[model samples]
Target: MAIISWREQMSLNYPPLDSEHQAFMKVINQASEDIKKRHIEGMEKMFQACYDYVRNHFSHEEDIMERIHYPEMEEHIASHQLFIKNISQFRQEFETADTVGKKLDASQKAMAFLSVWFLGHLISRDKPMKPYLVRLRNLPPRMNY
Candidate 1:
């Protein structure tokens, strides 16, 4: 079973952002499955992939927020930074466990953290951007003569 599943309610009504979010969910779901199977290698690989994707997605979002001059851009960027830091810490812990040849339940921890954070962010943080995005989308196209 996937830890998180995308639904209509989660949609921000922004296609690019929504697509990226869906991809994030899919990666986490795959990671959760790998964890259940005790596929350490696969789990680690997926974790790295997830981390990379998140960094890229965050950058992309920051760019949009910048372009839109989002009122809460600072707070949103801070949240993204905090998330990256947390994930980095988890990655270090996973590496330490690997080095010591101890079976650490890092995968479970990672899944739990990501699932909760993603949901909360989607609802609380991302939700606010909907109106702004809608307004942007509704703008008339510029035509150059």
Candidate 2:
């Protein structure tokens, strides 16, 4: 079973971002299930997919923020940076554990970290961007995401 499930309340009413968030939720849920089943290979694959997706997603989001000149851009970017750093650290731990024959434990820890961080970030940081996104929605289609 998956650890985290997506809720409609999590939506920020921005299609592109919402779609990305939904995709993230799917990956995290699958990863959580893989961890619970002790499927080391599956977990590793999911982790790599998530890591790549997050990097791209964050870059796209930051670009949007920059284009919009969001007032809280610095804070938001910092948060994104922290997330990337944390994921990198978790990846390192996972790799080290695998080298030491502790893959299961490290995978579980990584999944747990991702579950908590994903939900918290979506609610606290992403939700607040709704207003800004809504305003952006008013612009021409090309300008909007």
Candidate 3:
């Protein structure tokens, strides 16, 4: 049970970006599902995968933005940096806190942070960048819809 699930509406009309975002949601959902199932041993692995995948996604998007000469590139990068810091803090907290198996779940803060971050970044930053990406990439990017 995660707070959010990936939906077609979230697509940025860019195949690579859409696929990356879907992968992110899948990883997050899998971690949440594991926690709910009380799969104690694999929690660390799942969390690490989530974090690593996100870093990869961020890099991918940033590289595309750079090629576009996106005017808001620095601001978007700063926003991403803030997100990474929060996620890193959540990982640290999850590592040190000694909670029982059943009690372990994604913290509300982490869920909220992710929901807002995804929505805000996609809607505010991502949507606007699509045309530039399209023109720069000069290809029809895949999308969920």
Give Cα-based local distance difference scores for all models: 0.80, 0.79, 0.70
Error of 2 at 55 (Å): 2.1
Q: How accurate is candidate 2 locally (lDDT)?
A: 0.79
User: Distance from true position, residue 61, model 3, in Å?
Assistant: 1.0
Arrange candidates, best TM-score first: 2, 1, 3
TM-scores vs. true structure, each candidate: 0.87, 0.88, 0.77
Model 2 worst lDDT window (10 residues)? 136-145
Task: Output the TM-score of candidate 3.
Answer: 0.77
The model with the greater lDDT, 2 or 3, is: 2
lDDT of 2 by residue, 1-145 (tens): 6567778899888888999988888888888777767788887887788777777888888877876778888888888888888878878878877353477777777777888888888888778777787667556656435
User: Can you write out model 1's per-residue Cα lDDT over 1-145, one digit (the tens) per residue?
Assistant: 8889889999989998999999888888888788777788877886788678777888988877876778988999898888888888778778778542343476677778988998998888787888888656655664659
Q: Model 1, which residues run further than 4 Å from truth?
A: 99-104, 138-145
Per-residue lDDT value at 105 in model 2: 73
Q: Candidate 2: where is the Cα deviation over 4 Å? A: 98-101, 138-145
Query: Model 2 Cα displacement at 17 (Å)?
Result: 0.8
